[model samples]
Target chain A: MDEQRFLEYVQSGGQVETTDRMPDDYRSKLVKFIEMHGNSELMGVLPEREWILRAPTLQRKLALTAKVQDEVGHSQLIYRVVEDLGKPREQCLADLISGKSKFHNVFHYPTKTWGDVGVIAWLVDAAAIISQKALLKCSYAPYARIMKKICWEESFHILHGRDVVLTMMNGTDEQRELVQEALNRWWGPLMQFHGNPISKEDDPMYIWRIKSQGNEEARQQFLDGYVPQIWELGLTVPDPKLRKSDDGVWEYSEPDWDELKHVVTGHGPKTQERLEFRRKFLEQEAWVRSVVLAEAA
Target chain B: MSEKVQKIVEIADDELILGWRDSEWTGIAPSLEEDVAFSSIAQNEIGHARALYELAARELGTDADTLAFDRDPGEYLSAPLVEERRMDWAHTIARHFLYETADEIRLAALKDSDDAEVAGLAAKMDREEQYHRLHARMWRDRLQDEPRFVDALEELWPAAVAVLPEELRPQMSERLQLDLPSNSLLRGFERGSHSEELRPLLDEMTMVRRSVPGATW
Candidate 1:
């Protein structure tokens, strides 16, 4: 198929499979978009994995472990999709570690305390799920199909996050303080979690129908759904201008788009540390992969 | 402690510590598939630990979380085998395979316990462990010829034997087709003594709980 026809096909809500023919632009765009997602899931694991060993109870420990496992599982599922798109998983990792590719801005920051854990699962995941839910309508059939499972598991993470926050809120003053302090640190990145409010017409991801909504639309959905939940728990959002307008649109201070650009481009505080950590493990375990793959061959 | 409670806590400690060790691989396993698969095994082990602790809690008038997180490091009854911090994949898998093998024998005996509750829980745990055993065996098969894996299995054999009781050692030896070492050699790694690693593991494990004592997480 020619470029215009392929664009028209996806524009009309038509789905494309791996075997389907398409323009180079759409295929390359799809691979880049999806590969970043896979990288995010893998890199996202580090911040939370630090807290798994320190979970306050057996139930929390098991739940945290399972949640981290789900993220890793999501990475596996996502990398497989990328691999099917003609970019191998190994190359994706190498690029990610070498800082040649990007992941979401949120994961590049540090996870400071137990409170950071709760906020991340609750708020960060809430932001991510909004985008992921939009992807359920992706013009790529396989990626869209996998989003069903990813979104379902993500719902559980949101619940787990909310429960952690609620429990701490109901506990002592010190615990409540922990939640507030963490919220303060995380709110900036949370606002920047969705990219700048780029117009759908101008966004290639939207043009190709890889993402069904504009950046602003997804951010609005997150604010509308979660701001009330955060309020009900008596936790404060760091943004002063964060509120709903009379017309039902969310009006907020502009996020630090420069920081988002910088971080996702691999300059966030924890980016080098996290990428180095992943690089260390990948290199250390290279022999294990070689042995296993060689024997399987 | 009652003999039954002592037995329960011992098994619970092993699962708890070993699960803790296994979970260290959650995000950093050799491959993404292994990361996910190995994490499930870790979670299942912790789940088994919780169930076992809950059963013992009923007899001792405590809660599972308290038993799991509030105990002193010196009081932890985990075997030295599970306490060693071997983060590399080969040692991780070697411990996984050996611990699962030992646990299989221990759970089988528990399933036949005269106490109906103990036997029932053991039966349930055994079902979950079937998958864990399969996972361990699959890795063992894949890496059997690798020298590092073979060396790990050899180095960990005595500690693996120490995981079982004297009567159970023979069964484990038979199952693995390896001779049990002398009891004298296994005593140092046996239960009832905490490995130096357990203190730091417990300190990190209980830091959040300790930060705000008696406050519900």
Candidate 2:
């Protein structure tokens, strides 16, 4: 099929398999888009993993550990999909370490407190799940199939995060402050989490069916779904403009496009440290990989 | 603490500390499948420790969180094997395989104890230990001929012997398919033999709760 026909097919919700032939440009775009997602999931683990050790209670500890486990699991599934699409997992990891690839803007920031834990799970993951759920219908079958599992696992994280927030909210005043402080710091990143809005017709990810929803649509969905939950607990968002208009569109302070560009391009506060941490672990374990992978089982 | 409560505390500390060490590998293992499988084993070890702590908490008239976090670092009972932070995969796998082997002998002895509570708990723990053994063995097989694996096992073997009761030493040697250590087993790993690492881990782990002490969370 010609480029026009292939575009029509994807726009009409046609699914593509790995074996199916596609245009060079389409394939390249899919690889770039999906590789970034895999990178995000992998980087996302670094922040949350700390909380696994610091969880205040048994149930919270178990839930946080399991939730972090799911994030790693999602990364595994995502990388496998990318590998099947022609890029190897090692190559993906190498590019991530070299800062040659970008992940979501939010992961670059530090997770500072128990409150940050609750905010990340409740708001940050809520934002992510919106985009991930849209990808459940991704044109590439392998990537889409993994989304089903990733989205389901992420649901647990949302509940765990909200539980953390709500419990802290109902506790002592000091506890409540933790949640609010985290919210204040995180709201901007969360607002920018879905990336700057682009029209569906113009976004290449949308046209190629790698993303079934546009940037603005994903952000709005996050707002519509999570804003009430946030406000009901009496926590205020940093942005006064963050509200839904009568027409059902969210009108928020426009996210800092330049900031998103800057952070995701490897200049965020904690990017280098986190990547270096991953690099150190990989380096330390290189012997194990060399031994096991080389062995003829 | 009462004698019974003290025994519970000893084993509970060992399990909890080792579980914490195991969990350090959750995301970054050498392979994706190994990462997931290893995580489950880590979670189970922590789960087992939680269960054991809950039982001990009842006797001590406290809750699991209090038992897990409120203890002084000097009060922990983990063996030196679990306490040493083996971040490298070679050492990690060596400790994993060695500990699982040693634990099989200890759990087997507990499985037949005169105290029904101890026996019942041991039986439950043994079931989970089965998966831990499978996972440890898988790594052992994968890394059998590698020089690093061999060196790690040799370096860690002495501590591995120290993990089990003295009476069970022979059984552990048999289970691991290696000769017993020529030197006497290192002792003094029970409650109150805390690792220096526990102090820091506890400080970070308890920081949130301590910040708002007595709060519901």
Candidate 3:
């Protein structure tokens, strides 16, 4: 199909399959966008997997392990979509390690304490789910179908996060302080988790219907749903300017778009270390893959 | 602890530590499909540990969390075989195949124990472990020809046998169709001996819980 017709088709809520004809630019854009998501879900595992080892209770350990496992499963599901788009999974991994692609801004930061654990699962994932919910209407039907399961699995993470935060909030002063301190560390990243407030008309991801909502719309939904939950626990978000307006739009200090740009381009605190970790395992385990998956090739 | 309760704790610790090792591959498995599949097996092992811990908790007057996290590194009763660090996929799968083969025999004997609770939990565990056994055999069949996998199996085999008592180990060998190495040829860690690795593993595992003692996680 021609570019104009493809655009019209996607904008009008039509779905495109893997084998469908499309403009070269649209296919490239879809590959890049979807590959980064696969990268994000895979990269997302490193931060949480550390806590899986240190989870305070067996129940917490199992829950955290399962949650991180789900993230990995999501990555697997996502990368398959990317692979179907013509980029191989190994190529995606190589690009991720080489810093040629980006994941969400939040995953680039370091996770500090158990409190960071709760806040991440609660707040960071909350922000992500907001974006994922919009992708249910993604013009790429395969990507959209995967998002359905991804969103469903993530539903527990928020509750698990809340349970963790609330229990700590109700505990000793030290425990409450742990939660507050972690929230302070993570707030900036969480605010920037959704991209800058570009208009949907200006954002190609939105114009092509790869993402069904504008950046600002998803962030507003996150703040609206989660701020009350945060406040009710007597916890504080680091943003002094963060609040809801009379008409219900969340007005906050403008996110450090420069920092978002810098970090996503591979200069965050833990980016190199995380990438190296993945590279090490990928190399160390290459033989296993060669042996197990050789026949398919 | 009573021998019966102590036996339960020993088995729980084995599952707990091995499962922790298994879960190290949550995102890094060679294949994404295998990563997800392996992770479920890891989760199942931990689930089995939790159930076993709960059974022991009743007799010890503590909860599963306390028994799992409050104990010192030296106090964990896991086999020395599971205590060693293993991240290589070949080693991981090799150990997996060996451990599951032995676990099947171990669970079978427990399923006939005179202690009703022991016997009952064994029956449930066997039901759950059916998948683990199947997974192990499947991987074993696929990787049996790979030299590294074959080498890992030979290396880890002794430790795999050490998971069971001498009385039940012959059955493990019989079913696996491999000769059980003499105890002296096996350099595997003994049941009563915790490896140097176990201390650090336990420390990392309990770091968060240790930070705020008595705080709900």
Candidate 4:
């Protein structure tokens, strides 16, 4: 199919299969977007996996481990799609660690407390699930199909997150403070999680139908679903201007677009450290893979 | 604690701590396929620990969570082999293979325990360990020729032997097909010795609960 025709096809809700022909730009963009997502899920594990060891209770430990495992599985599914699209998993990893690619902004920050843990699961995951659900209609059929399973698995993460947050809310004043403090620290990054506002027509991801929701729309959805949940627990958002409008738009202090730009471009406080950690582990295990996948006689 | 309860706690602690170590690889294993399969093993270990704890909890008049989190590090009976925070992949896999091998032998003994409760639980846990063994064996075969993996297994061999009762050591040694080292088997550490790692882990793990000491969370 011609480039213009392919664009029209996707715009009109046509699904592109792996076997289908497409413009080089579309395939390249799909790989880049999906690879970054896979990278995000892989890097995301570093911030939370430690908690599995320190999980205060058996139930919490087990639940968190399972959740983290699910994220790993999701990344696996994602990378396989990327691999089929032309980039090898090794090349993707190299690009990720070499600072040639990007991951989501939120994972670049640190997880400071168990309250941070709860916040990540409850609010952060809720925000992510909103975006992921939108991708269920991704024009790339394989990516879209895997998203179905991802969205399904994420349903449990939301429940687990809500349960943790609810439990903390019902607990002592210090516990409640933990959640509030986490929210305060996380609000800026969370606001930027969906990226800065761009018109659907202008945003390539939206234009290509890889991302069905616009950035502002995703942020508003996050607010509509979660802001009330936060308020109900007597927690205050750091932004005073944050409020839902009569027409249902979420009004808030404009996020630090510069900071988002800075962080996503590899200057986040914890970006280098987290990437280095992943790189170190990957290097250490390189021998195992060499031997494991070595030609069987 | 009753005799039966104490015995179960010993085993439960071992499984819980080992599961924690295994779960460390959830997001960062050698491959995605191995990550998923390995994670299921980790979850299964925790599940086995929970079951054993519940059995003990009934006699101790407490619940599983309380037994899991409320205990002082010194009170835990997990072997040092499972408690070391080795992030190195070679050491990690070595310990994994060794522990699964030893655990299978111990579970076999327990499957025949005179106590019906212990025997039944061991039987159930054994079935789950079956998958764990398959995974470990798969990795061991793959990594056997690698120098780093061989070194790791040799270094950790003694510690793996200590994970079981004295009488079962021979069986474990036979399964591992290695000579019993002259090095002293690490013991007594289970109840009194803990890696410095436990304190920090507990700090993060309990941060939320500690913040609201009497609260529901």
Residues B117-206 of candidate 3: C-alpha lDDT, one tens digit per residue = 999999998997999889888888888898988999888888888889889988988888889888686664668777788988888998
Interface RMSD of each: 0.7, 1.4, 1.1, 2.1
lDDT of each: 0.92, 0.83, 0.88, 0.85
- Using DockQ as the measure, the top candidate is 1
Question: Per-residue alpha-carbon lDDT of model 2 for A36-77, expressed as tens digits?
Answer: 998898899889888777888767777877887788788888
Which parts of model 1 are misplaced by more than 4 Å? Answer: none
Predicted complex 3: DockQ: 0.79
Candidates' RMSD to native: 1.2, 1.8, 1.5, 2.2
Model 3 pairs whose backbones collide:
none
Which pairs in model 2 have colliding backbones?
none
lDDT of 1 by residue, B81-192 (tens): 9998998988998999999999999999999999999999999999999999999899999889889999999989999999988888989989999988877777679888
TM-score of each: 0.98, 0.96, 0.97, 0.94
Best-to-worst lDDT order: 1, 3, 4, 2
Order of models, best DockQ first: 1, 3, 2, 4
For candidate 2, give the docking quality class from DockQ.
Answer: medium
Roughly what TM-score does model 4 have, to 2 decimal places?
Answer: 0.94
lDDT tens digits, residue span A231-296, model 4: 998889999999888987889999999999999999999999999988888897887677766745
Q: How would the docking of model 4 be graded?
A: medium
Candidate 4 deviant stretches above 4 angstroms: A295-297, B182-216
- After TM-score superposition, the amount by which residue A75's alpha carbon in candidate 1 deviates from its true location, in angstroms, is 1.1
| Model 1 CAPRI rating | high
Error of 2 at A290 (Å): 1.6
For model 3, how does the per-residue alpha-carbon lDDT over A132-226 read when each residue is reduced to its tens digit? Answer: 99999999999999999999989899889889899899999999999999998888888888888888999999889999999889988999999
Per-residue CA lDDT of model 1 for A55-139, tens digit only, reads 9988899899999999999999999999998999999999999999999999998887899989999999999999999999999
